[model samples]
Target: MIKRYSKSMKKRDILVIAPQPFFIERGTPIAIDLLVRNLDNFGYSIDILAMPIGVSPNYDRIKIHRSLNYLNAKELKPGFTLKKIILEVGMVIKFITLMSKCNYRVVHAVEESIFWALLFRPVYKYLLVYDMDSSLVEQMVNRFRWLKSIENRLESIESYVCLKSDAVIAVCNSLADKAAKAGSKNIHLLTDVANLREQANIECKEDLNEISQNNKIALYVGNLEAYQGVTLLYEAARLLQQDKVEICIIIIGGSESDVQYYQNKVNGDGLKNLKFLGSRPVGMLEHYLMQADILLSPRIEGSNTPMKVFNYMASARPIIATDLNTHSQILNNERALLVPPSSVAFVNGIKKIIENEDYAQRLGSAAKEYVFREHGIDQFRRRLQIAYDTLK
Candidate 1:
């Protein structure tokens, strides 16, 4: 990791407690980088405490302080893990250490990290900002059967933080409504935006060239977590193969472990036509996107909008997404084909898009127009400023 912390910078007004790795090709980091950029524009000196995994974002006003990775591990994935539980304790200790060095006025924390910020609020007396990305309780219990014991207590803790935090900055309307249900009087909705262009140093078209253009390509770009609906997509792939559908569902992101695990599972099931390529750089995104006939955001769990939907809309590709609140908050019937998270539903949706070229093109065009008009860096910056303004 590149050390870029500078003592020359002025006093930091905010301490952004990001439990995820920073500057990585994933959801939370991308949003955090954007937050740093816009906060710099607004002249807020900030300190971000994150895991020791990701590369530096390299902004001037932002000084990054990573919590001790005691296990000497180099990478971390999304979701709740025992490793994360250990790291949270380290981060809380680090947060306490930083309180002695910097008198931060606001503490902006994402996900479950808000609990630590709240737990020590009386001592430090910082204005707490809960950056609600997703429902942490839902994320844990929906995925892991082992977390059933503490599920109710987890929900209670989420409600407690929402109620006590100085402000709640929700990522979507569904999350904002959730915060309201928990009695958070000061709630702000600051949604995510799309980064359409990639500053790619290396151009990659080797993988796309191998595929034949005989069948239409449907691309799914994101992590291969179960919550991301990769398993659902695997089932969809099988149904399509049985039905002799002529579309290819190309997966473009996952950790090495996830890729290997899913590939093994697919091989065991004898599923076909679902291609798995490990995570690609953000720069190669447009190159890969051009080869796609359709974009997908098939999240089976969580209410917050998937970060891919913004780019899916911005990519001008006809989208086929789950009809859950996760996608429907941003996508409607006219914008994209919203269907139930099922194999038959995906198969029919793919056929409908394939059969009607004009309709597909219209959906793509409408989505692009909507994304550019509503979800862009400008709006993200404006909403973020409004949230911070209240903290002042």
Candidate 2:
């Protein structure tokens, strides 16, 4: 029989394990914070076991434990062979210890770390919830081609995790379908929506004047990875240079190599309108989004419905994104200008928005209204509650 815990149980505890600690100033950490905060309102207690990702100090919330030691030399490799063995052994030891010491009713694993939680579910008797946000197998193959064999092996491991887990939570329908195909029995689609009301209410708005007076400011947020199509934006900016349509393209985040590669392309090609802002804090991000006339998300084909898309909706900005299945699922054609993944198409989309103010406002208003109603945190909380309640 499946063991269950009551909501009124005096010692009910939920354990969350992720690669980063909760309350950190990053995407996954912020998502965990939202989950914990929402669950707390329902009188559920939480315990967290987190590994540090960036250089920030560990957060101190309810029953949170942070790992002190970094991974050894062998654990830092790209492939899953040696790293998987080490992670499995380490997680099993840590989970066994935690199980012996506490009375956790649920074990929630985020991202690729669900494999570790599945290893201990048999002995611990906890409800294992596998949170699948991104396609690990696709990411491995796309990013690291040399490790194709290792990536294929890791795909089986992910499938095993899904098959063994009691529940699976995905950030989108595409990811949910992938997990279900991999043998996950109970699957829930949980889109990554921003706390729009909170972001809209941010008091700081001084950066509005910083926008270049000569150009129509277009903003792009999120990591500057190759698949994000940052280079395409630069190319589009270059194409619009002599059109007398002054356009300023602002990029938010990317690695050093990514930054350098794009910077060289912009400078070498004399694309003077493009500017790279690197990464910014969340507060500043809201300001940037609010000050912009348009938001651009030229993502290539991938299993990603980026979190930044919600923020774009929250900002009530006319968005020009690529016509991909994942993006089309979240955003309607009426809400955004869904263009083919090409520089010429991107440039035309921007031109359409700039030349027609009423059309842009209509699209932006529809996007904001739709996202606020359908993809807010309240919706996320309801979905999560349903998933948790099913454990009984």
Q: Which is the leading candidate under lDDT?
A: 1
Looking at model 1, report the run of 10 residues with the lowest lDDT sum. Answer: 1-10
In the range 40-59, model 1's lDDT, one tens digit per residue, is 77776678988877898767
Off by over 4 Å in 2: 1-12, 21-23, 54-61, 71-96, 147-156, 200-211, 255-261
TM-score of each: 0.93, 0.86
Full-model lDDT for every candidate: 0.84, 0.74
Candidate 2: worst 10 consecutive residues by lDDT?
72-81
Query: Candidate 1 — which pairs collide?
Result: none
lDDT (Cα, 0-100) at 372 in candidate 1: 80
Once fitted onto the true fold, the runs of candidate 1 whose alpha carbons sit more than 4 angstroms away are 1-10, 146-153, 198-202, 207-209, 267-272
TM-score of 1: 0.93
